[model samples]
Target chain A: MSTTTLLLLLVLVGVLTYLYRYAMIGLFASRSLPAWLHALCRHIAPASFAALTASGLFVAGGEVVFAFDTPRPWAALAAVLVAWRTRNVLATIGAGMAALYLLKLLFPT
Target chain B: MVQIPTSAGGEFLAGCRDEAPLLLGVAPFGMIYGIAALAAGVPAWVAQLASAIVFAGAAQLVIVQMLAAGAGFIPIALTSGLLNLRHVLYSASMAEYVRHLPRRWRLLLAYVLTDEAYAVAVLRYQQRHAAAADHAEHTDSGTPAADATADLRHWYFLGAGFTLWAGWQLSTAAGLLFGATIPPEWELDFAVPLTFIALLTLLLRERAGQAAALVAGLGALAFAALPYKLGLVAAIVLGLAAGAWAVRRLGPVR
Candidate 1:
């Protein structure tokens, strides 16, 4: 793509993305969401985060690995245990990273 | 509207603090994005420019990857646009919290909205709302418990957003400069999953919350092959539906 074309694409995406971010806010400005959507909205946080976490741990470079041989799932198990116990984000992440590096050293995968 | 007694500065700082834990995850992602851009032959200056304008990690990375592969201008733009469709949900969920702010402030906030910031901010709102509701019975004493939180939510949003903005820019610069040599030992990308797990553990206080999270996580794994990130959206929708069902079935415990 030419420099001008790249720039144009970038700008177009920015505009359209901004619109996606803004449209719902605009609709929601004047009125409240109905009861069912309200209930669903309440769950959005956990569900989305869960999906992200699972994908992060299980999917390596877009490929899903169900086998226990992968480092991520093993390390993530340690992370889950630490998080469940400590409920501290910093500690959980630190432990998970440390576990990953250690596993990488031992397993060399 | 009754004004909350908390200082704006205090609230902002609190927001920053709450967001601080998540930044560990963010910086690595930003660095990877930066490295990916340079790898795709996007000039350092142009990469930074796109970072500033686009400011979205996944989409910006997709732009570089697609462009490097000789994808046409239209698909590159559309791919990024599709990647951002989930933000519409974030905006809708957040609209009620931020609607009262001035239009300019609202627009700026909307611009800064991202998954990390939105997650922390929404969690904060949930906590504050719960705290306020706890004291609703004490309103006979005329303490405006919830009112203070309304204003604080916006300030927190700003503070979290500013931190993410700075972190992203700095990490991207580092990645551009030293991406190849960052060393695989760091395994920095793992932070993203760790951050989410930590957050989920901290946030899951009820059966409904548990249900939503499990379903979403499993669902995403099951639907991981869906193109255009639709799997993510589908997982989220199903997770939330499960949560709502659990709430209704369980009869809403505090």
Candidate 2:
């Protein structure tokens, strides 16, 4: 991409994204939301976080990859288990990295 | 609700403190984006500025990937926009809390909003609401009034958002300067998902939450083929529906 194109791309995406973030915030400030929207909002964290986590673990380069040779799945499993059991962020990340290294050593691929 | 002892400055400090640990994951994630942007042949200056210009990790990465693939500008822009559409949901969710603030404050906060910041800030808000509810119950009022802390909560939001912003800029610069020296073996990028997992775990205190998460995860896989990354959006919708259904099936939580 040329510098002009790149700059334009950056500006366009940036402005569009800002609009999306600001739409509800700026427009709905004075209006009261319906009960159903509030209910959906309550679950936004769980649903979005879960989707992000799963896609991060399973999808690669726009394709789903779940191979035994890859350590990500196993490492993520360990992280989830650690997270569930301890609810400690550092512990969860530590367990994930440790499991990834261990699996990499065992699988060597 | 109650006479909670917290000022704007105190809440600001609290926000900074809460977001501090997540910066560990954020710094490396920013570095990864910087390195990836350079590797994709994005000019170093553009790459650095993109951190602020685009100000989104996933979307920036997507833009660079498409650039490297020689995709057209329109396609790249569209994909990035679609990928970031999730922020709409976040805006709506946060509308109630910060709505009463001035337009300038709302604009500023919206500009800095990101997935990490939203997760941390929302969790704080929810916890405070829960505590206020508990206090009301103990007093036998059975009525949780409007949040009294709303006045200073934006300070907390600002504190968290600005901290993340600074971390992202520095990390992106570091990656542009020295990221190549970092080896792929380190796998620092995995920290991003691990952080998400940690946040997900905290959000899953009930069966309805678990159902939402499960459906969202599975739905993302099923819809992975959707163009412009709309699959994530669809998955989230399905997840929320599943959660709402589960809530009705199980009845309300007292």
Candidate 3:
């Protein structure tokens, strides 16, 4: 994309994103959400996060490969374990990154 | 009558203080975005502008990749918006505490609303509400409304937002300038997935969240071959469906 096009796209994306976030809060202000809707909202973060994380972790070159040789799945497991145990975001990220680099060195895949 | 906090500035500063650790966690991702935007051939000014304009790490990264691949503008913009739609839900959740603020303040707050800020703000609000409830039972009706506490929470959110916004802009600019110097073999790309993993781990602190994450992961894996990022769409739908189902079946936890 040309610079102008990229700039336009960036601005459009920014406005749309800000509106998506802002509109709901603006519209729903001072109104209590129904219990069911509130309950559904609780899932939004986890679900979206999971979708984003999983797509990055397992998909490679438009295919799914679940193999021990790939560092992602294993490193993710390590990260999850550390996170669950310590409930620490930084530690979990560090452990996962460390595992990936170590696996890369040992296996070279 | 409610007594507003005497030190909105101080409260905002303290909120920033609480968010310092999360800011650190987010900075590397911002730096990675900067580097990746440059690698994707976005112009230095455009790349930095994307950070300034979009101010969202994940959506900006997705937009950069799509633009590099020659995706149409409308599709790229829509996808970016869709990816960030979850923020709407966050806003809805956080609206209750900030609803009483003036319209101008609410509008500005909405602009700066983000995942980290929402998380910290809601937690603080809940804490304040609980304290108020505890005090209400023993106190007489003459006590003032607890607006000061709410003001403090709002200030905290401002600190968090300001810190995040500054870090994001500076890092993107740095990446645009210094990105080409870094070798490809450094595998900085891996950091993106690692960051998400860390975020997911932090999120799955409860059974419903854990279940939703598992469903999303498995769904994404199952539909990984879908074209045009359809797998991602499927993963989101399935994950949310799974989470909603879990809540329906088991009810809210705590």
Candidate 4:
């Protein structure tokens, strides 16, 4: 992309982001949130985070690859297990990395 | 919500302290974005400035990656917008908290908001507000009131947002300057996912949360073939809809 386009992209995202951040806040500046909306909003984080994690773990080079040869799924499994057991961020990260390295060594692809 | 009003400085410091652990994860994640952008052929200056301009780690990375893949500007912008649409929920949730503050403060805080910062800030807001609510309840029952409106809430938010901002900028700069030196084998790209996983784990203390995450992950994987990464957006929407259904079926976890 050209510099002008890159700048345009940035400007577009920047403005939209501010608007997203400002949308409901501005709309209901003084009003209390309806209970239904509040409940729906609560799900947004969990769902979005899960989606992000899945893409990061399962997709590479714009494709979904989940064979045993790839370490991401295996390592992510290890992370999920550790995270489930310990519920600690540091432990989960350390375990996931270690699992990835070990799988890489074993699979070598 | 104390006998004495806590100063804004105190809240700010607390915000800084609470963000310490998240920063540990963000440090590597920011550098990875810097290096990834450069590898994708984004100009070094634009790549680095994108960190501040977009200031959102995931969206910024996606934009650069899409650009490198020869995506059109409209697709790139749309993807970025869709990816970040989640922030609308965050801002809405936080709106009530900072609504009383000035528009200037609200705008800055909104810009500074990120997934990590929101995670920390919301927990603090819920806890602090709940405690104040409890105290106010007592006062309504004839107990003496004790400075119920004394939360330095905005300062706490500022402290958290600004710290993440600084960390992102510094680490991105580090990555751009030294990205060439770092070995490719380290797989720093994984840092962002790992960080998300950690955060997701923490968010899964409830059964409904677990259900939402499971469905969302499966949904994303199932729809991963969609063009322009519309799969991720599908996953988010599906996850949210499923989670709301689960909550309705099982009742709110809280």
Each candidate: how many clashes?
A: 1, 0, 2, 0
Local error of candidate 2 at residue B128 (angstroms)? 15
- DockQ each candidate and list the results: 0.45, 0.48, 0.53, 0.52
| Candidate 4, A41-74: lDDT as tens digits | 5666677678777776667656777666678788
Best by DockQ: 3
Q: Residue-wise lDDT of candidate 1 within B19-63, one digit each (tens)?
A: 888778778667767776666667788787777788887677557
Which 10 residues in a row give candidate 4 chain A its minimum summed lDDT?
A25-34
Candidate 4 residue runs with Cα over 4 Å from true position: A1-6, A24-27, A57-64, A106-109, B1-22, B39-41, B58-100, B114-160
Per-candidate TM-score, chain A = 0.63, 0.66, 0.72, 0.70
- Tens-digit per-residue lDDT, A1-109, candidate 3: 6778778778888888788667656766656556765665566567766776776666665677666667778888888788778887667768887888888899884
At residue A109, give the lDDT of candidate 4.
56
User: Candidate 4 on B31-113: residue-level lDDT in tens?
Assistant: 76787777777788898878878888868866765565455676567557766777777787787677766678877788887
Where is model 1 more than 4 Å wrong at Cα? A1-28, A59-64, B1-106, B113-164, B175-178, B224-230
* Number of the top TM-score candidate: 3
* Number of clashing residue pairs, candidate 1: 1
Candidate 2, A1-109: lDDT as tens digits? 6898899989999998888788788966556556676566667778877876777677665678786568988899999899989998778978998999888889885
Q: lDDT tens string, model 1, A1-109?
A: 6677777787888887777667666645676556665455456667867876776566544467776877878898999999998888678978998998898899875
Off by over 4 Å in 3: A1-9, A34-36, A67-73, B1-22, B39-41, B61-83, B93-97, B119-160, B175-178
Residue-level lDDT for B179 in candidate 1: 61
